[model samples]
Target: MTYRILLVDDEAMTKRSLYKILTGANASYRIVGEASDGAEALQIARREQPHLIITDISMPVMDGIELIQRLREDGLDMDIIILSGYGEFEYAQEALRHGVVDYILKPMKQEQVTLLVEKRFDHFMKSRQTAIIKSQLIAPISSAAERIGHELWIANEPGMRKEMRSLSGLLDDTEFMQEERISLLRDAASLISNRLQPQFPHQAWELPYEGQSYGQASESFAAWLDKLLNEIRDKRNWGKRGVIQQAIDYIKTNFADSELNLEKVLAPLGISSTHFYHMLMEETGMSYIAYLTQIRMDHAKELLEHSDLKTYEVGQRCGYPDYPHFTKRFKRQVGLSPSEYRKNMQQA
Candidate 1:
């Protein structure tokens, strides 16, 4: 299949050289667009939606690391090759962390670039096939499990062997339900839980059902099973949440860093500050700044209630350099001054 590629570099000659080399190599490849810096590159990326992006690490408006971060944050799955002239280990490490498909040190040789591109393209295809298999398998397994669970509920015949066989098939399916799948699994669990249990623990009836022999499943049992499955599904589905969770995790881990802010968070992720703000608001129901403020305020409140740290110290610990500003925000969120909040918690 033909692939569209984007070439982004600050230098005009670099862009021209790569474009010429790639377009000359094969009829299957096309140079879709070029950009001067990270910001323009992002604009082109959004517009072109290329299969592959080649970018330089150093640029005036935005850098390659930031570009990769932005694309990933936007949930774009394009393969990327990061180029740099400086051979900076830190830049390569940062690029890898944001999931760049490849990194190339500049003084670019045509053969080296071609080899890197070929490898990444093959890897991308394999990954895509795996994802497809996983998507197709989830529903059938879930349906089979539900059907078997229901059959066991109704039949007095020793069905553990049959049920186990069905479960084995179900487990083999790679397809998993996402959020709505959890609801269906919960319903199936409920169906299993409401059935009655056999009294004697025969080898066949020794199937584990709430620490008893199972004759039938009950509603409570189903709810319990549903809860367990839901937890598993939620954990698995976290990657789908994308940048919102990434931003939240970063904030949680680095909130105490004095320089932590919207710019710092979005820059590393390679997202434009504007788009980052919008996505954060959509996912979290709060603007980036407001979220950070809330995090700081929450931390301050905890320190006020649990620790001997003074309010200013608490503010500094939560990324607020200004003590009065921290106090003002804390009071706004908690409806009490730091000292008063602490006093009330102690009294209570």
Candidate 2:
């Protein structure tokens, strides 16, 4: 990639000579702007955001030192090379304190200029590539944490907890820089909380200690997550029984509605189909439809024994409006035709 260079000097001839040497020495280096003073260079720096800045120390209206201080204060990260005359050695020394990459004594040679640019450019390229790779690695952790959160809330099974623990291990991976890992702690916590907490409004989990160092914060976050998961597991265990009881009550009252399905049953409870399915299997060892049919058949047996309803009418009262379809299902489940079952009941 072409790296941009900003040339800052009070002399137009100096700017032109440096520009020509940079453009001629390397095809990868492009002079983006030339400033007559540090003030102009600051403006150009803000606009162009050059990868490297070559500036003279002696200039009117914002000298190089003041400009360096300003840029540093604003937290702009750029490689800077200072230019100084032989008599301005003190200025070069001071520039070194301000973190200039290198200083060139004036009456500069083409070779000196080209060599400094080449060295700085290599460092710049390496730094940029490292940053890009780090971001790529950290990017996927967000979505993975979100998926873990969904499963954690949907079911507090041991397998789900293991998956969550594995996701937290990503933060400990060495591929991320310390600062990136620290920042990701906040992001991971926020994502997990947003995904899981809405389903359990009373459960509270938050990242502890903002501004802590990466190692300290990561440890604290891991501990907090473990504690939060345990609390969630306990609460889910208590609430799971209540949730099933509530669903059973709803099914008993609404079994004959003909429109009862899993979605409608779960809508009022604000639970997902996957979660509801898991809960039913865990609690009753039956699928939702099986349980519903069992309820309907139990009630149908009561009607057959004590009521005078016809076979088809009895089926209709159990949420089956189609007579043959109801008769087929009844026989498959009961091993007798509905009419025969009613007849057997009469004899008994």
Candidate 3:
């Protein structure tokens, strides 16, 4: 597949230079759109959804950092690279935390840019895939674990074993390294432990997963699964609270994702929406929507009070893609606009 790219810069010359390099002989990249500034670039990005975005750190209206923030809030996952002059180099470095894949200096070294994108071609492709999956790579494993946990709840050893054996198959993404596979296996173990440990909290059961080879990791997981099956032969009480805590933990971790929703939360949970919602409300004294909103707003408060980022940037980072909506929510929740909150924090 030919990689699609969006080029953002005020300089016509820079755009020309990059276009030729990216589209040269034997090049597998296609420049889909060119924008003179970040604002226009953002509009084009919404329309084109390019796999890669090459932006200049200094631009009219929005600039590179805010552009990255906007893309992040919008959940448009794309590889980012910034171009900056020598004087603005340090300022450009600030965009690194915003997930720019890499950056280049103003006087374009065609060879270096080519090499940069080429070396990261695999990662770019992976990002493309992740964008499509929306991180179901982890979701599938989570859902499977939840399903198997159900089997384990009923002490259906046969059913649990079948589901346990199928865990490794979910890591079917292309170019999954051995270490990555092991990590996923470990995550599976954690999910299983969450289900099983509640029944016997005094003595925990864990997957005997060490830094072993792929084959050994799979074997270790299966062995642990067998042990789990043998130990929990009869149906035991797995508290609903553990499931609720897992859901809360997931919300806390993914609160920044604008696309965060009940469906995504329910995948790993294997619990009904009404049940999960009521459980969350009972445990936290807040509904699911309230809890999630509280987490995002609290994070926004921290970012605004501590960091030098703009109000809109803070809002977007807190899972509010629309600035006005964030303002409304912040006012309704915190009784102040983000800027006002920061001012009060400064004076305190």
Best by TM-score: 2
Give one digit per residue, the lDDT tens place, for model 2 in 1-348. 999999999999999999889898889998999999988899999999999999999999999998898889878879999999999998889999999999888999888998999999998887777676656544446545654564455343453465455555666654656777776667777877777655555344444545677768756766666666667668657454777768867887899978899988998898888988988765444688987886687567657756998888998999999989888888887777877777765542
Ranking by TM-score: 2, 3, 1
Candidate 3 lDDT tens digits, 128-165? 66544434455456646765765554455665776666
Residues 1-348, candidate 1, lDDT per residue (tens digit)? 667899999899998989888878767788899999999989889989999999999898788888888888888879888887665778888888887877878788999888887786676666666566544444434433444443333221233334444544443333433323333344434434433122111111112344331212223334443443344335335347577667777886788887886777876687788887776654444677777776676567557766998878988999878888877878887677877777765543
What overall lDDT, based on C-alpha atoms, would model 3 receive against the true structure? 0.77
Candidate 1 residues lying further than 4 Å off, grouped into runs, are 24-27, 155-160, 163-348
Candidate 3, which segments miss by more than 4 Å at Cα? 25-27, 125-175, 183-220, 234-348
TM-score of each: 0.46, 0.56, 0.50
RMSD of each: 25.8, 17.6, 19.6
- Which ranges of candidate 2 are over 4 A from the true structure? 70-76, 85-102, 105-115, 134-139, 154-182, 194-221, 234-348
